[model samples]
Target chain A: MTAGVPVEPGTVRIAVDLLGGDGAPAVVVDGALRAFGADPDLHLLLVGPPEAADELLGVVHPADRERISVRPVQRGVAMTDDPRRLSRADTTVRAAVAAVVDRTADAVVSAGATGATVTAAVLGFGRWPDVRRPALIATMPALAGPVVLLDVGGSFEARPGTLARHAVLGAAYATVVHGVAHPRVGLLSVGTEAGKGDRARRAADPVLTLAPLPPGAHYVGLVEGYDITSGDRADVIVTDGFTGNILLKGIEGAYAMAGGPPASGGAPRAAALLGVAGTVVVCHGAARDDDLASGIALAAHLYRRGATAAISGLLADHARDGHLTGPGTAADGPGRTDHGADERTEETP
Target chain B: MTAGVPVEPGTVRIAVDLLGGDGAPAVVVDGALRAFGADPDLHLLLVGPPEAADELLGVVHPADRERISVRPVQRGVAMTDDPRRLSRADTTVRAAVAAVVDRTADAVVSAGATGATVTAAVLGFGRWPDVRRPALIATMPALAGPVVLLDVGGSFEARPGTLARHAVLGAAYATVVHGVAHPRVGLLSVGTEAGKGDRARRAADPVLTLAPLPPGAHYVGLVEGYDITSGDRADVIVTDGFTGNILLKGIEGAYAMAGGPPASGGAPRAAALLGVAGTVVVCHGAARDDDLASGIALAAHLYRRGATAAISGLLADHARDGHLTGPGTAADGPGRTDHGADERTEETP
Candidate 1:
């Protein structure tokens, strides 16, 4: 599907990858039950072995059993498995993503390894037209607002073109998913100075300045690593997947070192996969029960908000203008649409 | 100077960059005063304007005035100034570094821009035979113990050869500075799995495995960002300068978000500059007086422990064996000495 099927309000069906996490079946079942009890209108498509499905159905209220349906598949991808394993179609993460592409579920949540889930989502749902490489967005609860960090682990390479494109994706995600109407996006660098970063960041800074962002979003030069938690510098922070993943884990580790996290919350173990055609949330491979539950909740929330569809549509506007750097023949076509005027006509005007 | 002059016990003199931080001279004066008051045997060589030095001496007790001396330098490098400005002998940071190189001081501490300080130290102190690029090592107080993080902002690039050399440096620093025997060194990668990192990491991993470390130090394979705080996986974490700096700042920001750091301390605002011949410590550009004081204290600690000489002494042993990668004439000479086996003859043998 080029675009995700529009999610209906108050009835979000999420495909849960029962065998996705290190504590598979057990922790996944606990997370599913918790999410089911909290969100009355939520439904779950259990994709794993029949025994694992039976384990969850046993504890769930019989009346609520109607909300959950089992899709049995014994084969699942292990954390150490190669990404090519997703082609088998029987892996729990692949099957979970397939449910969304086939319209059997509104979104997918997996506590599996990020690489496996990202590969499955890309293979199953396909990438967005303007997104050559997908991005994973992780939000940290800063004092001012939530800091949206992108490309957490979608890909390792940090080409200048990819960093700029991810900036666009991150800006849209911040506005649509986090409700930041006029999001301030910044390129994550070692220092906030003009020429303060590795070669990729130095090259990406000028490109980000020229790249046309969606309506109500502006690029605010370079930001330091501290901005990720302070939220005083920018709302959306763009970085290479390698640096983003390391930074997230480092922040999480620091929180753990500092007795506990602040009253707001700890570092997020779940991240939303952007640039895919379907809504997907990936939890940490070693996810705890609450982390899985939070991942499920994040998926449901994104589905309910129609975030995937809205973000894709916003990017489509930029894609038509050739503002987003991607691999596509349509980018130079005469049939391309222009809605640049429509963007500024809103609040930003 | 290829080798630093050995420091005398109970008479370690430190050169303080008077015009170093965002709050120059004033905050530096406060820091120098604090450092002077705390250590009875410490001597200070103030390197800045004569006016700034006189202001400091105005407040000091008459009896202790003999311990403080002035090396007048009217010019100071600004954060935005070109790094080449360090070539000007008039700059305070360069003058401070010269003090250590010329045996006027045992160590140097600067709260200036990291790039400028690194440049000054390299120019004044010269580099060790096997170090192509200098390294900034910051030790974090993790739950288990002090976690040694290297290349905080030594350079921007991450070549395989450089990373392997940095592993050796980090391993040696942990052993000598932190008093940790049998230091388990780990390359900071996205995952602990063998093949999970950027191209540089993939290439460097194997080199690290084959790279012979000093006494009681061994490669522990790839480690994640969590290892930087938990200290469970590795005692010495090696990463590229860019990633290391960002991770350090991110952890510091996380601690701020979580209200305060644990009882031990927050992420260090000061770091020791390695690979140079003399002892040097660089504080954050935005460091407070207490942070500068801590930086001074760190410089004092390194001077007292004779860390720079010892680390270089150890690296020289590797240089003699041609185990280190660098462009140096001394590395190819037959006159290179042998002191590595001596390190282990005491206990590891």
Candidate 2:
């Protein structure tokens, strides 16, 4: 080792919600151990009941045990509870988010209800000024490379303004996280034509086309559902939360039906909550051991890559121009009050 | 041998629009040849340009030529044109529907635009008395069996009433087509819980539960995206065409990604247009030769099995009782008007 050489910094401390998934302490413990074992520099701030952390500690080698720490809290958010329940104080998901806010942990990872995790992240870390709604972005390892699909389950409604903002978020994510040079963004529609989707898409098209993107990103008009896996047309695909959630599950089911996923891996069971100040990744409530491990890896990846800070910096410039907010982007779009996947356990896949 | 005998009528004549696809007469002609060669009892009333039918005639066996006839008119409905274009005289799709109306053909099939085929079927044969917005149904092969998914691209708006009607249509189709004695119908939503989807789904859930279904059919509440392909929860899954179209394509892409489709089949490129009195099947505009042949086969199967008449009869009884129209179901929901996947393409498969 050379004395003057700059040391590599790969230490990533992820706050893991021990009471997050369907199997709760059991699945979370297994996943954390797996993630910790895979990366030598990885550290975990186990956030849940002391008993849950003890279970994770029971398995780690004495030498590696130093990398794991505990932030004990008893309460866990039930899948049926409203996402706003995270504000009730000391809930595992909320505590996990708080760990990141207080710098006790570098990032947050959870398999608790998506809505609860999103709410907690927004409340604890705050949202970016230019992005009204925080989006859940999942990267699919497409044939062309990694394709970033956003709003997997953050919010249900798709306003012209929200969609325009998502374009910026996705474009920046593709550049900072996936490292695509000039990210091509696209709005998910039924067809690739100019006028081929529903009302929300039709209205959002012109708005997304008008809005300016960050860095070297540009809009690629409309792309179809096929483009998500193929990656022939767009590197970043923007869609309302409802369609995105369904598409994610549908792709996962197809992979399962086809016996296994492609070599690059299947649709992600975890998605990163973009626009929040701190890095946060939400896993499916029914996520398996590997899904939880992958979620932890994703959170660690975000922290190591400075994705949240960098994407926020990208959007800040757009906000300065006053062109960030989309036209007709108010608190909510017309007619649609608040709609999305019910805040509950996803049992299908 | 008996001195006198009566031959059972096994002939099922189909009117096919040769100019319906992106590949047009070439793919259609090849498909017609394939179909004619496969079924000895099948008859064709080709309804495109005389030259196109002549192309088909060029390949038919001399003895089998008696089973083919031409209803030549040289117009095709361009996919980009509005669905209302079917009203223009001499359009191939319109002529095909007219052939079914006049009893010259037992059914009609087109690889043309979906909206145009639905419109032509409605105008030429009239919508069934019980149904409002005619739905398009595609049968996807699942591990359990066949799952009937409706409104693949029929219309965009998801009115509570319209959804209730589609449930009835889907239920009857499942029983008659797949022969499931008790078809379990599920409203396609984000979750399986009672309140699991957006406003449209929330409003439709209660209405579907309260609505009386056909014989041996029952509602299974809300089902997630996985149920469409897995068929573990329900036999019939209902959703707005915008969502259905996107999900269908997304599933197709996933299959393509996972090497190929399962042994059963890939996503159906052709879907049956339900709620119309006459039998009609619409294929993708970019349909290959096999897809075009399948469209013709689907149309013939519906006619031979009396699926259109039987399903209509099943709905008629409910229509007589005034249970077919859902509560708060009008033309459009409340605010939205006349917006859907432009009645042009059923393409993008």
Candidate 3:
């Protein structure tokens, strides 16, 4: 029966948590159907109750029905649940990550509570070597080009070493995934001048200036918040997750207030999870069907581009070159303690 | 000579810093001319070099020349100059503030470095009783009337007491100035949930919950950055200056990226100085001629409304009831110290 399935060379299987977003099951079912209908070679592994999977199968074209599969799981992480509960292995997001671990799917996509998703991914796929805290990178569709913003919600630490590592990750991701050559990386602050931000930013700026960037990327001096949307100064904007998350949402709100986004695009509803061993995408918790579909498409695209492996390889190369140091290293200097533990339970976008 | 000039009952006198902002003198001249031409009941007290004042004089219609007066001072504070240097009396921003102190001007407007303007304002106008830190409040013209965002650049500290104090200021400003009947004040965070932010926000959230708000104002719990532009959640959004300044500029940049702002309006270029004894508006340091003109107009409107005196009276009422507590009070709880001094030297918007 399996041999009869037509699996094309470009086929990319995605494990999606059905009970993820605020409009879960319904929106996820509709989103899965839309994603399946949009890409002929796409396959979905639905990780939720059988009823939700049936809803998608009921409406899909008869000819394309074979592309869908199901992994029944009744329990799902609640938005208010502690992230540590993901260890139970029965939650839908965890099941989805397990599919990726078992090689049944190429990647995982979930719009569930971000803390739960990040914890599940970390437990199932593991973190990259020397990466103490993972970073979530969002691409803003600026008019000039794509502006990559990092640590949107992965880790909220403001440590200089953490920011410096994320800068390297962001530069590599922009170059590897977005095809940005010699990406200009910047530290986001209140102003562009060198000592213009809070204690964390002021400390991180000099560390980033001295830290070795990925092969082609170079650190631009401090860049302001305007630079995030303008995309005039830096290709990759590195900031603490606390600031990045709020700023990303603020830009999204501004676009909504302006009737709609620009000709280029609006703030992205989907963000890529870096510093993890497998490809993963997390959508907004209040995501609509289209946003979930976009998340699925982003996961597939990243898997097809071998983005996870390529970025991990770049980090490894840097580590091997003795340039990469994890959090709390001497490179971070004094006053740079790990603030990630306390903020680990906060929800992401 | 001054008695010959027409002084209407509605006339507002504003001291304009002719050497403030990036495009100093030239853009300031154009801005002052634009402001003078637009408002028939406006009076200008130009503070800058003799040549720059003469430039504005050269362009004005001869019939309206009496409405403009010049205070010749050679030195203007450079963006790179330390804000502490504003103690020198000859600087343009200090001189502008001095005009307000001497009863020659009803308000002061400057596009100079925020730290310098804030320092000068503190020295000239003095802070309100129990107001340790001054806040810069910018009003975003949302679809639903207006949204007031505070601590744009006045103080960068994240102390719980400071945030609580700013919340009171914001609620009063929204009610008295924006005429918001009953303002819903919210603490800006990564998420709307109670425990969804970093350490500072987590500490500040509970403090705000119990802090005594002015009459006709209520705490709406926590709000995200999107609330600033959407105007869906709260009328007053409070955050530390570091976050507020960046978010405001980010919204402005988003508007620029969206071609233009909505019919309602865009991000405000001028922010009112709250917690000070006098009416003051600080324009963006990168202000263009139109932005500077808008700052002047905002100053005039605020002065005409007697917003500063009214808000101060409201605060006094609250304090008389024994509800207002300044920074470092027991109301702030433990771990809330004054982080204002360190960031005082950093340039504002």
Candidate 4:
């Protein structure tokens, strides 16, 4: 799916959390309208209060009325809300995820608290068999091409096993969604040298080097932060969510400070969720109308590309071949499988 | 020490590592010359092979030769060299540190491997009594005057105690060096909300909130990555070395991609070493001549302002008042004191 080209032929039903962002409802309505106007084949399942959904429906032409639907979730998770509240079915983000699980929508999109959305998605659509922790993968417009960075906020722990698994998820996403051939995956660290980072990076480096990647994808040792924008060292950069999330925002802020982004594009405000059974896209909490629109487009693009199933199928194929019994796989036992489960109680929304 | 203003009144002697960076003697020699020419009171003690030092001496006027001294250290640490080799006295970075220890130079500046320089500084100058882990602090020219970011590459672990201490160190540095009255100190996390970060950050938040800061400094809770560039949230941003190093470079890369940095200034390539008893500045390993010159100037500026001594004295005063008896202090016991000592064997230079 090429960026800047708004039109695509496939009809993608997206369940958008109308009360997700800091600007919520108003921006979501405006963004949904912009996205709806841009794409002729787009369908939105507005999951929020009826008043907010009606605001969007009232603006669109009568002929487009049939394409939009409302789930009417009165409650929306607050940015300061506890993530545990996502378990409630009435929350807009959880209701959005429910739309996907019930087959009412093709994908899910939200600008809500990341932990809440991740939790709702995991509860609504279970994780893939071989995968434990899911990752949020963002595509950066780099000098070379699109650079895929993962675990932006899906998982915060810097586990070596999780990083190794993210490498697989990033490579598969790059290849399947971005259409990159033989994507070079690199673990993000302080320096490109073998042991140039903290304890977590030092431990993850060798694991990533040895872990089997999807066909046409290879591990490129270690890479520094410059590789994220320059894209000279690797096509997919894997890092812990804590670092990746901060770096992503840091880049966005730098771009803002420098007047604007480069000609190619700027840091993405939206990211695709990987390792879940359904397609999911997350936008920044402070997303503007354009950012929210871009996120909706990204969700539609992922759904149309069949990225979730294709990437899962690739990992399952590798698992059947005995190549996926590594640290992050099911073979690591029940203890490791509790990746996002514990965070529901520990994390804030 | 104001940026862009090249000249200072006091004569500050800096020990330059001629064989440090990826470009080694060429850029170091060129940068040393640029720094020497810019500041009339700058005295450089060239610490490298006689041949490399003589290359700089050859071009200067005979009368100016008196200000330049040569230490004639033939050995230099390679980027891929073992960090433990810093224990050797002959390497350029170590010899440069020795110049400060023996009062031959007021400060040391190097573009050598960060871990090596950090280890060498710890061994040569010894960490401050109350500071178990030394931190590398870089001042970014933000929309506000300057934002001080700590642990850029000194310590990599994300221990809660370490972060709390670094907050104290950063607050002291900002107040003493940058002259920010009532500096707002912030713990770098994923979000501004109280509990919006990883396990380390979650644990570090309360500790920092309760940790007694230097006089005229106050804890401002958690801040996001955007604050580093915006400088709207906090004057001092504290983070682990792993995250800080990557974020610093990420901002640099974004600025490069955006054509150039904003009108304020670009991301800093040089960072000052805090917690060490002597003044030292570390340049990026891939530093260009201008960056190297900036690093040298930064070292001279630190020396002229007596930053190291003043910050340390402030912390010492706090320690005397029992405010420093927390997790990172000598009271934390010997286990915590071995911060940089163990990394000598584990890390690569």
Best by lDDT: 3
Listed in order, the DockQ scores are 0.34, 0.43, 0.56, 0.52
Writing each residue's lDDT as its tens digit, candidate 1 over A276-306 gives: 9999988887788878778888888888888
Write model 3 residue lDDT over B173-210, tens digit each, in one string. 99988889899999998888778787778878898999
* Candidate 2: Cα lDDT at B242: 77
Ranking by TM-score: 3, 4, 2, 1
For each candidate in turn, the TM-score is 0.90, 0.92, 0.95, 0.95
In model 3, chain B matches the true chain B with a TM-score of 0.95
Q: After superposing candidate 3, which stretches have Cα over 4 Å from the reference?
A: A1-9, A83-87, A336-341, B1-9, B83-86, B336-341
- Indicate which candidate wins on DockQ: 3
Give per-residue CA lDDT, model 2, range A79-165, as digits (tens): 676544645677888998899888989999998877678778878988777666788888888888889998787876677777788
For each candidate, the alpha-carbon lDDT, in order, equals 0.78, 0.79, 0.84, 0.82
- In angstroms and one decimal each, the interface RMSD of every candidate reads 14.0, 4.0, 2.6, 4.7
The sequence of per-residue lDDT tens digits that candidate 4 reaches over residues A199-314 is 56776788788889999999999898888998999999998777888899899899999999998888898888888899988888888898888999998888888888888888
TM-score of chain A of each: 0.90, 0.91, 0.95, 0.93
Answer with 2 or 4, whichever has the higher DockQ.
4
- Candidate 4 lDDT over B314-342, as tens digits, reads 99898888787744343233432111223
Model 2 quality (TM-score): 0.92
Q: How much is the lDDT of residue A110 in candidate 3?
A: 91
Docking class of 1: acceptable
Lowest-lDDT window of 10 residues in candidate 4 chain A?
Answer: A337-346
Clashes of each: 0, 0, 0, 0
**Model 3 per-residue lDDT tens digits across residues A239-301:** 888888889999999999898888878888888899889998998898889888888888888
